[model samples]
Target: MFRKSLDDLLNWKNSKTRKPLIIRGARQVGKTWLMKEFGKTHYEKAAYINFDNNERMESLFNGNLDIERIITALQIETGVKIGTQNTLIIFDEVQEVPRALTSLKYFCENASEYHIIAAGSLLGVALHPGTSFPVGKVEFLDLYPLNFLEFLSAMGNDELVELLKSKDFSLITTFKGKYIDLLKQYYYIGGMPAVVASFIEDADYEKVRQLQKEILMAYEQDFSKHAPNEAVPRIRMLWSSTPAQLAKENRKFIYGLIRQGARVKEYELAMTWLIDCGLIYRISRVT
Candidate 1:
């Protein structure tokens, strides 16, 4: 509910030379909701188009890279007059339609007047290889789980959030119990937006864990549906071992935990796939 990215979106809107924005994150991290809310609050109207299994969208961007034609069709589709100053055009799941992603290049070069934001669950993976991604034509914003202050804001603790922001150590020390209790809740709840929302509303730990498991299952489905066949098993193995890997004292990710004789090379593709899809985070060791 309280996303700091909206502040960055505001900055992007006011900039003189703004390019199309791509909001990237893992599935169910509120990327789509953030884009729509920014549009609702900041603009006269938002034209939202989802490209996931959208056949009409496929036809729309498939024809040519002519900016005018595309804009006109978008106008017809979204029922909002495409305007330079007021309308926010949101291309959701743009990765599903590679041509639409490519068309952003022409939009950046030719139709810079219009504001466009594109986002999808696995857009990061789609931009690699084969797809002619609009490399230099788009700006990117990443949405992550709520940090401590943001979590406070979501729980209607605006004053506490502001106090934390003020960086008053003596004052914070006095509020240790309150902060500690919230921090413990956050530890159990984690930071995924949906989980936070559900927890905030119902305070059901069982439901929260269920939602997380569902999200995990969706990711496994993505592995089977989207990842290469040979790597799927390796991905599952590596994924299943993450808890044990982190349980070690050093907290280093070890390939050996994935299997008795596992090597990095053997599971590198799986790791790369997870990273590319924003499913996992990797902290590299300093050389």
Candidate 2:
């Protein structure tokens, strides 16, 4: 899979003063895979540590913030040599351990020579409630579902992507049938990497829908798994209402839609949770 974000990664690698980088995206949007790919291609060796359910790693950070001690522990855990210049350290699912999220600050300040990329599906949502964020200590790259052109490229329609880039309306209009057909496919497939790859290889609409449904299920599972217990129901409510919310002509989120006589005050946290998880897209009305 050719990711457009590879260009951004390359640019970051070439920068003189780079901080720890965070790749933010919805779950299953290939954040982890992209980080691994970049590391494999660019670095001599990569040290990958997933903080989710790693008890040893959780304990490793409870002690002092000694850079060498941390490095030693990381080398033992990942079995990869950690060098300042040639090794890329990836912290996956860092939100599970709050201290791991905060460790980026120390890495930024004391170990600036090391290249680190951290990512978590719920990292944005985790910042709420008592979670302290490492503000101004890391750079971020936001990844979204493949846009229209990327969708075309992934489907082996490179010529169509080239045509869109050219912006020649006359030529585009000449190929309206082809573009419309592909656009409809994108609407149904919706650009999740697994769904798109399946459609590309098999051209199966049923399989595509199945993949999308599975992704949606995984997102719901994440709500209960990662969100606070009190906020879980509210999050699920807001999430379930997203299709209806977008289906309406007035797309602004309405609290009442979630329940009978629902008030914004009641579901604000739910809205925030959905946004934090990248489960729904929000467009605010601007007067």
Q: TM-score for all predictions? A: 0.97, 0.92
Where's the lowest-lDDT run of ten residues in candidate 2?
Answer: 124-133
Q: What's the lDDT for all of these models?
A: 0.89, 0.86
lDDT of 2 at 182: 90
Each candidate's root-mean-square deviation in Å?
1.3, 2.0
Candidate 1: which stretches are off by over 4 Å? 127-129
Judging by lDDT against the true structure, name the best candidate.
Answer: 1
